[model samples]
Target: MSSDEVRARVRVVSPRTSAARTRVTSIASEIDDQTRLGEVYIVSLMRSQLRLAVGVLAVLAVTLGGLPLLFHLVPQIGRIELFGVPLPWLLLSVFAFAEIIVLGWLYVRQAEKNEDDFSDLLEGR
Candidate 1:
């Protein structure tokens, strides 16, 4: 093609024009302003944390509190000894602390996960 014909075939494309985009509100701003949506988010986070706490507490109560009842119902368990330490004493002292520690760790991890999810929502992720 001739230079003039080549020039006619080419057209200018505007860089500024594109598909329509929606404006997004910042969650941080909404929260800072204490908007209704922000309140809802906050309440949701609180509820999740509360639910986690209640669940952990319930588990601890059932397992630890049931120990005494179990020992009472089965007196033989107290007579059994492990390396000179009574079975019930070993369970209450050593195993109980381990259980508590595990439960505490689980509670903390779940609580942190809930907070992380809340933050992700806040960040619009």
Candidate 2:
């Protein structure tokens, strides 16, 4: 083939910096240096998670504590039949137990979401 008819191809690579990479490096450096901003970010994440826990605890206390009081205040409610079982038994075995399971599952999911959010914040995502 003639030089004029021949085609040549070459590959090249250039260094590049992304916002994500830059942010990661900067944040890592700040962490390594123990900067105030990094500490503040961590504290904020902890505060949010702690606040969530406290709120859930408050709700659980109210719900679990109130149930017995409600039953005590309404004695007839305890004797009522539900699905051929006593109301109190059904409440304890089914409703309360289900609530426990649901609350545990919900707490786990929400806590995981909070952790994921914290991770995203750390990664600047």
Candidate 3:
């Protein structure tokens, strides 16, 4: 046989097939199946949400809880009046309520953002 013929006879044939390709699975299906990876994803989201809640609560606690201390530390603050109401009372009522509302809004917005991030993660973005 000639050298070219010998080379052609020894040519390789690849064994690759569709089965060799990586499988694509849906993230929702993985979660529905309660897979380990799914559980990890869920835990991560929960932890982030929990951390956010704790941070907000801490801020609320420090602001609200410190009011009494502030009043005691600065007696003049109690002596001042606003619209015929004691400064402390005004702050505790209107300011506290406004702060609570703002904090609640922040909490909701951040929670939604966290959920969106989690969704993006599941979608492989």
What candidate 1 gets wrong by more than 4 Å, as runs, is 1-26, 29-36
Residue ranges of candidate 2 with Cα displaced over 4 Å:
1-24, 28-34
lDDT of 3 by residue, 35-119 (tens): 8977888999999999999999899879998888887888899899989999889888899999999999999999999999998
The TM-scores, one per candidate, come to 0.69, 0.69, 0.69
- What does the lDDT read for residue 98 in candidate 1? 100
Q: Whose lDDT is higher: candidate 2's or candidate 3's?
A: 3
Candidate 1 per-residue C-alpha lDDT over 19-119 given as tens digits, one digit per residue, 9 for 90 to 100: 21111345677667798977887889999999999999899889998888888899999889999999888888999999999999999999999999987
Q: Write the per-residue lDDT of candidate 2 for residues 83-109, one digit (tens) a residue.
A: 889888887777888888888888889
Highest lDDT, which number? 3
Model 2 lDDT on a 0 to 1 scale: 0.77
Model 2 lowest lDDT segment of ten: 7-16
Superposition TM-score, candidate 3 onto the true structure: 0.69
Taking every candidate in turn, the Cα RMSD to the unseen true structure, in Å, is 6.6, 7.1, 6.0
